[model samples]
Target: MNDPDGGTAAMALGAAESGALDRDAADPGHRDRFLIPPARGGRYSDSAYLAGNSLGLQPVATRNRLLEDLGEWARLGVEGHHDALRPWLPYHALLTEPAARLVGALPRETVVMNSLTVNLHLLMVSFYRPRGTRTRILIEDTAFPSDSYAVRSQAVFHGLDPDSTVLRARSADEVRDVLAARGENIALVLLGGVNYLTGELLDISAITAAGHAAGAVVGWDLAHAAGNVPLRLHDWEVDFAAWCSYKYLNAGPGAVAGAFVHERHLGGAGPPRLEGWWSTEEQTRFEMAPVSRPPASADAWQVSNPPILAMSPVLTSLRLFDDIGMDVLRARGMRLSGYLYELLEGIGADVLTPADPPRRGSQVSIRVGTGAAALCSRLSGEFGVVADAREPDVLRMAPTALYSTHHDCWRAAAALAALLPEVS
Candidate 1:
């Protein structure tokens, strides 16, 4: 059958395995830079890894750079702080510019430090100030567990009821409605840039503007958004944002995360921040004075010395993104994810992610009734299609642009068809 573009239906729809292979040949991504895992239970040699959203595949350069950092530690011991190749004292500095480029922020507005939740808490120390009747926090209904816990704890720390202080909205429209109605009561608006489970990409600029109009400080959990989508945190006028490195950033597990504080909130007599040795100005940090002299940058938000070892992988990953660029990656991601969504729909699977390319990222989740865990295990162990399961009945597959290919998406769809014959 012929398609509207005058190509065969299979070629146009990307339905056949050969069609996927053809697409890969025509539009090969940066797959060579990553190490693909070997298949455990399929005819193919490599596993069609679709779980970059959970934990990204290791970059080829990660090991050598990591070993080099370790070598510096062994060679210089205590002296490595100032004398090492990258210099442990300023190691985190190497990551700042590249990370800033990745998330579209100024160098002074971005800092790589601590875990995601830790950064959120530190930023909250300066941003989540609850006073009088304007003490509520607004968040999405499907906020990640860590975010839910962190916000609840913050409310508790402020001597307020968690249940009463936290308001959950079901969608972006609801968020707008809540802001319009109870805007005065909300002190902060914290939402995910991309919903983890549904892969929905919210309008950061619009939301931030709305929150500001309502007299609320806006922050974003970019754990799934940072590397997956293009961001302009500074241009968006975002008050603050935080993201982990292990997911779309492709750093190692529990790697050092990053935070962004808009330039408007930096330095001066702005909101008070929790301070430490690192928070003090670099020139006077060694003076050991009683009063801290924080810098006029996002570095003021840091509370402890950065772990050099953890920062190594993050540096490598950020450099990779810097070289390739997020704009290039985001475009490829939309094409790949759109193809996978179409294939899944052709097989009669129920997708949870938005159909429109602009509303979602690389992830495509599906409702598989009960046994979602069992289905995911079968996909990995039986078909070598690595996907992740979320709780009762959601299975997620991400066609990561850096390493994933159309052939990998084809394998996943074919596997689902074989396993779920009833649906097919």
Candidate 2:
């Protein structure tokens, strides 16, 4: 079978016993750079950690990286801005090149900035302009709640009714149809690059073209898409995008996030946005002039000086991405998740995520009958598996390419099979 990222699959692991797992282990070399907790036996081993969709495991390099930054801060004090290792003045640039590689954007179009929601609001301030009759906003009905809230609040800020002005589409085809009919009235089209609940990967390039054809600006909330899959944000001609670093990027919890604005939007005629001293030219930033002269890059979206300590872990994780590259990781994710899907199919549970290889990421969200959350609890406590439960019935399990193995997928599937009679 062809891999979703445009390569032929070398081999796909259909079951845990398949030697494909052994082959993948040597090539990508899993479970070494990461530090997974030992299962109760006092020996280090990978537990069934299937929750990268919610929070990723820590990279071992993060500790030394943080200590280095702290030591520099203690040694140099105020002088660290220019004198210490990784000079504080230009620290954010350290993450820019690797991050650009991960998202398929040029360095000039991307910036490591505030958290995901903050960047979303900041981008909307510049792009969500509702003039005269084009005052509506479009989002997926299954979008993460924070995205929906931000779009609704933007509509309200523009004096439009949240109920009527914020429209919801159920699928990609629906987006194209609506844009043909009502897109002339749309101020913005913002949707999740991957659905958080169902693990659906949307057709971003197609949607962006449709939105532009109808004269509406398009943006993507890529919190679930950024590092899980390969993205061509610039080649897709995306107007703007924002994503968090805590999930597949494997930065620490609530780590700093990132934003991207096309080169076309960074020029003098670009849309107006809220600015800070950091958005100005570095040579002139300390001048403290009253007027704003924002640079012609995505860095102009920065609202304040970055919190350096919070950004340290991002460097540690992004460096690993630079080493392994997105192509290998995405291919491994397909095999790992495909193994889990085969196991789950034999167990008779309803899998909500798309079965098509190209239409989904590494996650497999299962729909249990009655006690889904409690089943997840049992899977964690008794079976030593860690998967997340979303509300009533969905259990999201992600077999991350960085740390998880085919054995972990088998263990999780066996645990679910054992608990199914009680859950059903």
Best-fitting candidate, measured by lDDT?
1
**lDDT (0 to 1) per candidate:** 0.92, 0.86
lDDT of the structure predicted as candidate 1: 0.92
Q: What TM-score does prediction 1 earn?
A: 0.96
| Steric clash pairs (candidate 2) | none
| Per-candidate TM-score against the hidden true structure | 0.96, 0.93
Tens digits of per-residue lDDT, candidate 2, 228-275, equal 999999999999999999999999899999999998898787998998
- Identify the runs in model 2 with alpha carbons over 4 angstroms from their true place: 1-28, 40-45
Candidate 1 segments whose C-alpha is farther than 4 A from its true place = 1-15, 422-424
lDDT of 1 by residue, 1-424 (tens): 0112222323434358888999999999999999999998889999999999999999999999999999999999989999999999988899999999999999999999999999999999899999999999999999999999999999999999999999999999999999999999999999999999999999999999999999999999999998999999999999999999999999989989999999999878978999998999998899999999999999998889999999999999999998999999999999999999988887667789999999999999998757888899999998899999897888999999999999999999888766665322
RMSD list, candidates in order: 3.7, 5.4
Each candidate: how many clashes? 0, 0
